[model samples]
Target: MTRVRGTPSPSAPARDDVTSLLRHASLTRFLIARVGSITAQQMLMLAISWHMYDLTSSAWDLGLVGLFQFIPGLATTLLAGHCADRMHRGRMVAICLAAQAVTAALLVVSTATHSVTREVLLGLSLVLGAIRPFQMAGQQALLPMLVPPSLLARSMALSTVVQQISVIAGPALGGVLFAISVVTVYLTSAALFCMSAVMYAFVRYDYIPSPREPVTAESILAGLRFIWRNPLLLGGISLDLFAVLFGGATALLPVYAKEILHVGPQGLGLLRSAPAAGALCVGLILSRRAIGSGVGKKLLIAVAVYGISIAGFGLSRWFPASLLLLAISGGADTISVIVRQTLVQLETPDRMRGRVAAVNTLFIGASNQLGEFESGVTASALGVVGSVVLGGCATILVSLMWSRLFKPLATRDALR
Candidate 1:
């Protein structure tokens, strides 16, 4: 097993990495199950949101749907991480998925019987919010178990590809099905959830037992301390938090597409999709060739590139230019995300990965929600373009500041 200390295992034939990855039955099954579950999640989200609107016709309720999910997801982060560390990770994911499946089935029955109501939807949303952190904790912690350290990054890239594709396809599929029948979408999504849960139950991995740490305030907080004590982990995670917090302009896409670019709803869809398209391309490239050296520097550069692209997107008046800028931003973000995740997974010990991952997820979740709020407030004050441009600049500044503040992270030579 002699190899680069912090690099992925020796490179397989470029063509074979993916095949090699697939040949690992556990990883393969998990990936397949992910496609089903994530796609179903997207479909379920769309159906629920649309149904809520149909029932209440209130935009405030639509916003409440997200708020409910976010707050609970945020509130349960530490406990969820503890569970991931203590539990059978894959089975934990299976249970979560199974719960979701039941929820979807209930939705189907309710919709069919005209028994669905806004309150039911909100309550379910609360349940979903609580479930997500547990699922995420288990799923992310489980990946390293299914693959060796060397293959972790490549596997993550491939996983990203699966996610991007699922995110893209799910809504469209759900939309088409919804147009046919709302009940149809729910039933289909429920089936997918059940399939993913069953597949997850069968995906096996070797396990090393972490001490059955007493569930204490200190134990729940251990992951946070572990990350803080490790500079690379802290830098990588915080960099993602701040960079995305400032650079993400997703909330402003509608403003640009509608008023600035004059592109209308059809164009807005394309704008919304530009980043995913870009991320998909980069994820594919990384699946074959991961960042091997100069890991820290590359991560910073990627964040900087993301910032520049966001700034460019903010300034662009042409529809095509906006798309290109957003795509570039997406590609850069994919690199940042992969690098950050790799760092977090590889640097942390197995027993502690769950807690560390939980903390990581919290940073990310906060960034996404706060980023949108920041964008809206700034757009209101600075004008949409000014707000976006300033946010991008702030992102770039964060990258530069982080590079200096976390030199160990910035000068790190490898990801292993």
Candidate 2:
């Protein structure tokens, strides 16, 4: 065959220049699966929180739910990271999804049978907590393998956008379902998880398992060691840990929805969705615009803004005002999340990605759960308004302290 070769096609380069993050087949498939799974998870979370409060109006009981969820992640962090490094990540994620589907189904049954108690809910949270670390570690580690290095930041931003979309929609859906019947919410969540598992099955990727090593105490501690040794990573992770631990005002929304805001379950859903609504908008913007220089300073500024917004949320009595405040907080948080995740992913080697990701998961899980627990405890003692205000102030202080303490984090200029 004789072919005349001329100038190369401009279409190829033009297509490459287009900035859509979902261009890659593997990334697109993974994101679709993630959207389904995240939507289900968010719906389930709202259902569980509302159901727990309906059973017992006590704040401490709500806190215990978070505590139970945190314990499993704390206990099995190392083992989960190790598994992500050595196991088939896709298969592991599918298995985790299967387990979660079963759990959701059980909740449906329990709700229908009128046997769903706070204790039962707590138990299920423990099961989920155990499954989450492994699932998250595997997914985080697998992302770099799926996308070109240059597209990683955009991919992360796009992922956040999907998650934020789910966060906004899921709670609204859950509230509608819960209004019809609590059982319906659980059933829908179960169906979504099963669907997510099927979508995950379609993702094509290869896992290069880490070299085999004897499971030892030191081996298990590798993730923690890596974070500790790297100041930038340490600062980024710890900044998030402390900020969320102190500034988490969202945990008290259920209380505000009922007691302060005078809103019904539907209204509660709106409140739950507000922050994510803001986050979704911000993530969409970030997906297209690259993070420029002074990445560290931007992160710090974002966290401080988050704290300010949280405080504003705590003081607002009007529903619209509160929602706006929460949305601003979410927007600020989105920036911090993007910077922190990108930093962690770009800095770590592939061999250590799983372990480092596990450590990051632990910090995030702990901050969320423990923050919920703290909010609940403080609400019980200090009153909801006081607790939220105090926590928000603490978050602001944390941001300042971290900026001074970890100069490297504040001085960071670029993603690479």
Candidate 3:
């Protein structure tokens, strides 16, 4: 096969032609596949939240949605990751996309028919959550196949920004569309999922998984043991996990919009977007700049920045101030996340990528959805502001402690 002008094969490090890798068509298609799926997912979330709240007018219902979403992620992540390694990764991704698209269509039809019941919503949410971990794991594993290692960092960063773009737009659009008709929101979200499935269909690249002997239970266990023993990989994944577990404030946006900031639903959209907006800007910067040695230290500092920004946002009353603070928080948090993801991708062997990526997904999924549950519970117990402030402080302290504990992992340079 002829290599593109910019993209190197997986065997080559991407540092040689970073510019071309970023601009390559195949990479762009991969990005589209990523962005479309993520955007549709977030849109469905916005729709679900808005629709549920509109029906019940209860915060507890919103929290329950988070619970349902997180449970499947925790339960299925390892299995999903294992499958990614053993199966055709692209096809695995396609299967997940198809499942999600079906869920989206179901959501739309239910809404349009006015048959949207709580039971139906909860069931679909569970199915979506179950499949999402695999989609996430598969995509991450498939990435090294799309670009060279040197460019993996940039590609991952770019992928993050692109997903954020959808998130930034999805909720705001969902909010507006929901006011007009929940059916409209669901239909639009379903359309995006279909687009994503179509994009994945066209990706056309085959990822060659590591050739190992016959698949057995021991082989899967070996992947788990690898992550268990690798201090750097363990530390990198844990660092981000613990940090976000405490500091994730996305769950509190609705409360802030209503009680504290007085922005209402539209304001909620903007508030939800603040962090992504900041992360998007930072992603662009990292795409141009190369990561250096001692990225561990950088990761720690960035998380601290993230903690401080979350704290500042917690205290903020002005909309613009809150937005700016969240943006700063987003930027700092993004750097830490990107570094962690890059390290995970670089450190793992090809044979173990699915398992390791699945573990990564489990931690991150916990940080995101379970963290939301924690935040909501804490905010309900304490005030929203109190929860945000305390969570931010905990995040900073945890990152510092983890940095010390994982000193060996932090100090090492990239594998390439």
Model 2, stretches more than 4 Å misplaced?
A: 1-20
lDDT of 2 by residue, 1-416 (tens): 11112212213332233244556677787888898898899889888988988899877777777878889999887788887777767777878898899999999999999999988999999999998888889888777777656667777888899899989989999888877898999999999999998877766665555578988878778989999999999999999999999898666788899989999789899998999999999998888888889999999999999999998889999999999999999999999999999999889987778889899989998889888999999998999998889888998899889889999999999887
Provide the lowest-lDDT 10-residue window in model 2: 1-10
* lDDT for position 407 in model 2: 96
TM-score to native of every candidate shown: 0.84, 0.95, 0.92
Worst 10 residues of 1 by lDDT: 1-10
The digit string of per-residue lDDT tens for model 1 on 116-149 reads 9999898888888778888888998888887666
Give the higher-lDDT candidate: 1 or 3. Answer: 1
* lDDT at 283, model 3: 81
Global lDDT scores for all candidate models: 0.81, 0.85, 0.79
lDDT of 3: 0.79
The Cα RMSD of model 2 versus the native structure comes to: 4.5
Off by over 4 Å in 3: 1-19, 208-217, 413-416
- After TM-score superposition, what is the CA distance of residue 64 in candidate 2 from its true location, in Å? 1.3
Query: Per-residue alpha-carbon lDDT of model 3 for 239-307, expressed as tens digits?
Result: 878888889888778778878898887888788888889988888787767666778788888989898
